[model samples]
Structures are given as structure tokens and as C-alpha cells.
Target: MISLLLVVGVLVAMFVAFNIGGSTTGPAFGPAVGAGAISKPVAAGLMGVFFFLGAWTLGRNVVTKLGSELVVDTGVFTLTTSITVLFFIGVALLVGNVFGVPASTSMTAVGAIAGLGLAGGVLDFAVMGEIVVWWVVSPIVGFWVSLIVGRYVYDRLDELVAMERSEGPLFTVDRSGSVPVPRVHRTTNRRELAGTATVVGIGCLMAFSSGTSNIANAVAPLVGSGNLAMNPAIALGGLAVTVGAFTIARRTLETMGSDITELPLTAAIVVAAVSSTLVVFLSALGIPASFVIIATMSVVGLGWGRATRRVPAPAVVTGDGESDDPLREGTDTDATEVPNPSALFDPLTTARIVLMQNVVPVVATVGAYLTFRYVPIFGF
Candidate 1:
């Protein structure tokens, strides 16, 4: 029976780790893949390597905090509670995948632990309050920062692209007296901004941060059991989880990058940079926060702000080539042609995505809480 229970616990841990990989990979790789900055296979390879580094190096701190420091006794983490938490989080992630939404690993993991703690009569109200406060604040902060930066950067690029388009291509002549070849005048402003340097830098930082920040999710439960030391377990778990995420996260990345927004390379870069930095900062402080929530909110807010300023209303063309819609007669059609708001910033989709992401954490947390409250009544 003891051996059977150990197998069950290991299986549960593996399931949770797989889900973490799927959910976490999107934030690390979505921008590069979606923006055509890197080929899919290359992105996957880099993601695997950097994610391991992140998890192995910085993941230990987060693991320690979530596993042991937040609660009173690790002994309370029985196989039953571990299985229950695993089930709740697994179900939540499956639901999100079904609906084509990206759920958050950090949120689900922390919520489950908190719920279990509450049910076990180990509720740390003060610590819970701090976690909640950060959860609420991080995304808002990320959104505003992204919004401002995205606008400035995108506008400048737009102006530069316009300039390049207006001035025709340059020409060069060969010494052999052959026909003059058209020299490609690369737009330094827009094109250079999204070049290799920028992409590589962002990719490295995001992968590192992802690995570092997500250590808490996979190893927290094990860490909670006082029989184990926190650092080694966290390092091993982080490496394993990062590998899993790099392999399986592609599906989730497709959901976030294409389904949520038609992210241009520059905009995606900005969002990743800002969101990853925020998550990393929180992780360094040993605070449990949601990278999915942060990245999604930042991307949506940036897209929304850009859409409002640039997206024009629909119009009907008249016989004489005039617009029949009075409201849109003189509006800018160049910006409106792409259907930016409708394609990328649909309210229903945004709400659904947010709901799916939050549900896993919420349900898992609540279930753990209830179990903790009622387990004694069953005479366990």
C-alpha cells in the first residue's frame, strides 16, 4: 500500500509538471514564433535550453517559499491532499485547453496549495493577502507600462515605414557595365527595430525568467513535506519542468499568439519584455504570481490602445467613389483595412481567455480549502 501510494504521488506530480510545461511555454516562446522572429523548431530548441537554466538557477528560491515558508507544517501534505490538488489543477488546465484559452500554472498551483492550507487549518491570512495584492497589482502595472511603451515604439516605426515607402528604392551600378541593380533600402526604423539582436535578447530574457519564476509550481508540494530539502528538489524539478514546457507549450503558444491577438513583431517583443521582467521581479522576491495573466493583460491592453487610436469605423463606398457613411466618410482607411480591433481585441474572446485562466487556480484553491475543512469529519 505504501509503494502504491508513492507511485500515485509521483504520477500526480508528473501530471502537474506536464501541465506546467504546456501553460508556461507560451509566455516564453509565443512572441518569437508568432512574430516570425524565429522558426518554430528553433524556438522550441532555445526554449528547452534556457528554460532549464532558469529553473535550475533561480527556481530554488520560489520553491522554498511556496513549499515550506508559507504554511506551518509540511506533515499535513498527505497523498490524499496532493492528489486532490493535482486533480483540481489538471482539470482546470484541460478546461482551458478545450476552450482555446491559456491558463496560468503559477495561479493554479498557488491556489491549490492555499486551499489545502486553509482546509488543513494552516491558513496564513497575512501571506495570502500579500499574494493577492501582488496578483492584482502586477498585471495592471504591466499593462500600463506596455501600453505606453508599445504606443511610442509602434508610432515611431509607422512613421519610418511611411518614409521608406515614399522614397523609392536606391540603385547601384556594377563596374562590369551590367544593368543597374536596385539596392534594397532597408528601413532602419521599423525593420531594424525587430532585427536579430532585439529578438535574441528578448527570447533569452523571457526563457530565463520563465524557468526561474515557475520553480514554485512543480516543486512546491514536495517542498511542503519537511522530510525533503527545498533547493535540490526545486532545481531538479525546475529542469524537468522546463524541458516539458518547451516540448508541449507550442499548442498553448498558438492559442495565445494567433487567437488572442495578431501580434506584430515589435508589439509582441514589447509585451514579452515587460511581462517577463515583472514576473522575474516577483519570483526574485519569492512571490507567487501569474505570468499568463500578466502577459495576456499586457498584450490585450497594448492592442486595445493601438486599436482605439488607429482603427477606423466601417464605411460604405458610393457610386462616385465617395464614402456613404457620414461618420466614416473622411476616416483613415489605411489603418482600418486590417480590422485590428475585431481581429485582435474582441471583448468576448478576452473575457473568455481571462475566465479560463483564472478558473483553474480558483477551483483548485477552493477545492483544497473545502477538503481541508471537511477531512476531519470523515475520520481520516
Candidate 2:
């Protein structure tokens, strides 16, 4: 009983969801795969599984919010209108990826939907306000939690999770037994195995959180159109995600794990755990959280916290309480110079970085709002 328009709408939704998978796979598994703790196939497989689990359970609430609650009247979501709304959201993703901004899918989806609702005079301010509140608060919460972990616990965690890859293959298939059994290499110690497991496990957790947050963005429009039921929509979106994970995520994994930043295995694991857990919690509450911002803030917080500990004092005062060794203070130091740890976090640099990220969502929201309201092409 599916109409042609309905089928086309579903295809568009799948396209968006597929991209969601590709975008999410990088953050979810790039570290583990990049660090050689796991292979790309393994990472992609895990992302598909965990993403489904998350979407099947906690992600449903978000779907409800987007499909039914955001607009007081579901009548606004005609098949054509739904496609139009989703198109804009997809464009936001394109803009982000092209411009190196990696925009928040949650924010863009909401903005486009809100725009449609506003144009139709059915936008729910209460729901929009609630979503906005979480958007504002969640990052702050992540920063503080990460700040704590960065300061008091990161060192101990690092000490415990220090990763040292063993020589030879970590495990090899042995045909000596009745069935193929994986045997640890003679060089692979228990500690090294545990370290590898930790990294891969955190990657899986991040994948789960990504599913929870992103599933709704992929299929909410289809669900709103009444062409698909919730469960079917979720399954379709999950399948698209799997396709994205296997195909496009390969490149993203390489970029994040190798090109963007070089991080120690322990630090990567910690950041993965903190950011993913926060995202899962938010998705459970039907709020779409930003993994990009959360993870970035976590890295910053963890680094800043670690840096502040045992910071070199501001004034290395002599017995006369004067500045110590003026020549060494501001002059270009030798390559071997041990700089003060107090220089660990630059306030201006950090502030600018965070501010720049915030600007993308703001621009997206305004753009979507204006486009939906004023564009006569949508036939709203």
C-alpha cells in the first residue's frame, strides 16, 4: 500500500541516515581502529550492532519527540513537506562536512523541523524550549565531568591503561583443535590484551551512543509522514547505518585516528568512555546530544585538568622576591627547554575554539528558520 511519493520519501530518509552512519562511525571507532586495537571491519560491525541496540531501545523516545511532539499537529508533515524538511537537514550535514565544521545533526534536524512547524503555525514552543535547554546544559555538564576526570583520575587511569602492543599477531587461529580456536601469541601478555579490549570496548560504547542520538535524525521525517511506523523506520535507518559504516566510515576512521590528532591509547579510551556515556544518557531522555562537541570538550577538559596539576608557580621569586632570570622568561628558549606547565591551557585559544563550534549550530538554526518561513517553493 505504499505510494510512489512515500517510496521516494523513504529513500531520502535512508540517504540521510546512511550519511549519519558514516559521520558517526569516525568518532565511535576511529581511535580503536586507528590505534590497531581493532580492524575496520570489526569496528564497522560493532557500530552497526550497538547502533541498532541503542536505536531500538533508548532512541525511540527521541523519535517520538521529533515526529509527534515537536509540531502540535501532524498534518503539517505531508510527504512533500517531509522531503523538503529532510533535504535542508541533509544540506546542513553537507555544509558541515565540506567546511570542516562537522555540524550537529541534532541541531540542524530540529531547526528544519521547527522551521516547518513555525511556517505552519503549529510549532510547539514548550518542546522547542526543552530541547534548547538540554542543548545548552549537556555540553557544560560534559565539560565539568571531564574536567573532574582530567584532574583527579586521568593520571591513575593512564597508569592503569598504559598500552603496549605485543610482538607478532595478538591472536592466531589454530587448526590443531577440532574447531578453530583463537590462541594468544607467545608475546601477547595479559595486560596488553586487556589494554586492547578496553580501547575496542570504549569504541563500541561510543557507537551505541551515536545510534541513540542519530537514529531519530534519520527517520523522524518518515515517521512523521505516516508512511512508515516507528519500528520499521528504526530498522530501515539502522540498515542504512550499517551500509554507511562499512563503506564510507573507512575513510573517516583513517582521518580521525591518524590525521586529526595523535592521542595516547589511554587518553583515547578515557575520552571515548566519557563522551559516549554522556550521549547515551541524553538520548535516553529524548535529547539529541552532539558527540563532536562533547568529545572535544572532554579532551580539552582532561588536558587542562592534567596540566593544572603541579603547575609551575607564577612567580619563581628569589630571596629578594623579584622575577627570576629575566633572560629566560620571554626569550626564545633552547629546544630542550622545559617550559612551565602553567602554559598547558591557553585561555584565549580554548575559548575561541569552543566559540567557533557554537557558531555553526547558531547559523544553521537561523538559516533553517528563515528558509522554512520565507521560501515559497516548499508549498507549505
Overall lDDT per candidate, in order of appearance: 0.67, 0.78
lDDT of 2 at 129: 95
Least accurate 10 contiguous residues by lDDT in model 2: 331-340
For model 1, the superposed segments whose C-alpha errors exceed 4 Å read 1-4, 34-41, 157-194, 242-247, 250-261, 308-344, 375-380
Query: In model 2, what is the error at residue 47, expressed in angstroms?
Result: 0.9
Q: Tens digits of per-residue lDDT for model 1 on 34-55?
A: 5544566666677667766776
In model 2, the runs with Cα more than 4 Å from the true position are 257-261, 311-356, 377-380
Model 2 clashing residue pairs (backbone): none
State the weakest 10-residue window (summed lDDT) of model 1.
162-171
Cα error, candidate 1, residue 32 (Å)? 2.9
Q: Report the error of model 1 at residue 167, Å.
A: 23
lDDT of 1: 0.67
